[model samples]
Target: MSLSEEPIAPTPTTQQDAPSGFEETESVNTSMQEFHQLYQKLLVITLVLTGIIFISVWIFYSLNTALNYLIGACTGVVYLKMLAKDVEQLGAEKNRLSKNRFALFVGLIVLATQWHDLHVLPIFLGFLTYKATLLVYTVQTAFISDS
Candidate 1:
């Protein structure tokens, strides 16, 4: 048979072809994984720092004192604010609320574990209230903007 009568197999892609894993879906998934890693790092750091500060303050001052409680509560709130801002600055604005919500939930759990004997009920309750309020606000804003 003549050469032209034979079946031809497809040639492999040349170097100019993009890498196999460089497709759009893979790129998007990689971006999301990167963000997830960053968020986990931030959260771990935040929790460690919060625990250190809380224990140091408790060791130096009476947890039942109004002033000490005020300082601790405010410090926790400020830490939350800072965490939110840092996440936003890291280009996690789309996930800010969810991150904050999760962090707050964990913080409250940690607080319960560490301060269960210090009459810190008010602070825990207050922090939860604040977080819930923010959650409601975020949902409201999202809905309103969607409409």
Candidate 2:
């Protein structure tokens, strides 16, 4: 018989050689912990940036404008939290993102247009604070080395 015709015997695997359910669970738990930590860090950074900018705007601009900005900033925070929750649910509890968070922005814009005290410019700019935070964090992670 030729070498190609020879039957190959399967090597038996030991129980210790295979990954256990506990190990799989531990790895998943570790991944979730890391995700939560990243989410918390992003949230904290966004809040700090919002506070600093809000104070500066209040100092340089009118209280009405500051209040409008605050309203938008708070909405942005809520929208971000909702978005994060949706992201966490992706592939687990949800197949797609929820659009309810976007209603917050639309409501803010509609209110701004109808209200006498609120201006669209400041509110829109304030709403962009979250995007700025995400951009800065992306840049920081890309260029800065972790020690």
At residue 107, candidate 2 shows an lDDT of: 92
Q: Which candidate number maximizes lDDT?
A: 2
Candidate 1, poorest ten consecutive residues by summed lDDT = 125-134
Backbone clashes counted, model 2: 0
Where model 1 places Cα greater than 4 Å from the true spot, the runs are 1-22, 65-147
Q: Residue 114 CA error for candidate 1 (Å)?
A: 22
Report the error of model 1 at residue 111, Å. 15
Backbone clashes in model 2, listed as residue pairs: none
Q: Each model's TM-score?
A: 0.39, 0.80
lDDT (10s digit) by residue, model 1, range 98-135: 44545654675576568645445545543433344355
